[model samples]
Target: MNWYVVYTKPKWEKKVAEQLKKSGIECYCPLITVMRQWSDRKKKVEVPLFNSFVFVQLPDSDRNLVFQSVGVVRYLFWLGKPAIVRDEEIKIIKKGLDGTDSCEITIVPFQIGDKIALDSGPFSTQTAIVQEVNNTHYVLVLESLGCVLKMKYK
Candidate 1:
């Protein structure tokens, strides 16, 4: 089996994967976990690492089947030709997927005093001081509010 890249319609990765499976194409789509907060509550969610693409393992004879499949835009290309992914890179990705719980969230590294653009909450777009850092989250003090908020970065 050879690995090929399949580009999908915007936000259609999962749908395309399902269709590909029914057509007997083996595929992989890595996901990252995120913490989502709403007005009344907070919960964990998983999102794709690459927004609208998936890797599929298929033979050359069935390659056309993929091109004709619904939700598939085309194989990833360069110089007007289908591009090939290196075996080593695919192996590395497979290793990471095999080793970790894909839903395990992690933090973005922050150095002390680093100026950060707030990504969410009431202070969105404001600058804050990175007071502390930990796995999957960080502590930022909103100077004007005199309150420190814990935020998930990954």
Candidate 2:
């Protein structure tokens, strides 16, 4: 069986994943706990890491089984075929979210005015220029996109 990406209705990633599981289909919807502030109060909620997206592992012949779940729009495509998610990639996501304190991450030092390329997130593959650097955060300017991004260290 191969893992394929599924597009779900907005704000429905978790529901779709639950439905797929009930049908005996293996699925993964990575979630993160985020702090949300409202006018009245602030709360922490678990939200899908990738909005409107979920991953399902199923054989090619059983691909249509996913349609039985509501909110599932369609399989994500790449190069005119269904996008495949490698098992190792899935393991990495799981390990990162497990919060076991065993994962080690090293941040490479960047100097101001240095050119860099984003490897992940919504701006993946886009080149940016380092504009400012400080102890807590850094600013990047995406000239092609005409936007400035500020990333904070955790």
Candidate 3:
């Protein structure tokens, strides 16, 4: 058995994980608590660490079983094959989140003017150039899509 990445509908990570678990499929949807502000009030909410993604552990033959659950789109693919998450990597993620009072994970550093391909979302497979970078967000120019995308980070 191997751990595979599952792409899901936006904001459905937790729901899909719950469904998978009820069906006896072991899954992981890493979540973190963050303060979100509304016009009237501010509240702390738990959100998935990786948006629209959940991890499932199952044998290769059972991959299709995940689709029976609503909100699951498909398995994430890499290099023309389903992406596999190593067991050690999964353990590290669990340990990092479990062992910390407050944990911060930094993605690879992106510099201004660096060109990169989006791995997920509506912009998946599109190449974008980094227009601006800061501690809270990134301004990306998606030439193919003819739009500027601002991505926020914690």
Name the best candidate (by TM-score): 2
Residue 1 CA error for candidate 2 (Å)?
A: 0.9
Per-residue lDDT over 20-64 for candidate 2, one digit per residue giving the tens place of the 0 to 100 score: 999999999999999999999999999999999999999999999
The segments of candidate 3 whose C-alpha lies over 4 angstroms from its true place after superposition are 101-154
Backbone clashes in each candidate structure, one number apiece?
A: 0, 0, 0
Cα displacement (Å) at residue 80, model 2: 0.5
Ranking by TM-score: 2, 3, 1
lDDT of 3 by residue, 31-102 (tens): 988999999999999999999999999999998999999999999999999999999999989887785666
**Top model number, lDDT:** 2
Q: Is candidate 1 or candidate 2 better by lDDT?
A: 2
Return the clash pairs for model 2, or none: none
* Tens digit of per-residue lDDT, candidate 1, span 1-154: 7788899998888888888888888887777778999999999987777888888888777888876568889888878877767678888877776756557688757887787887767788778898888878888887867898888855
At residue 57, what lDDT does model 3 achieve?
98
Q: Please report how far candidate 1 places residue 83 from its true position, in Å.
A: 1.4
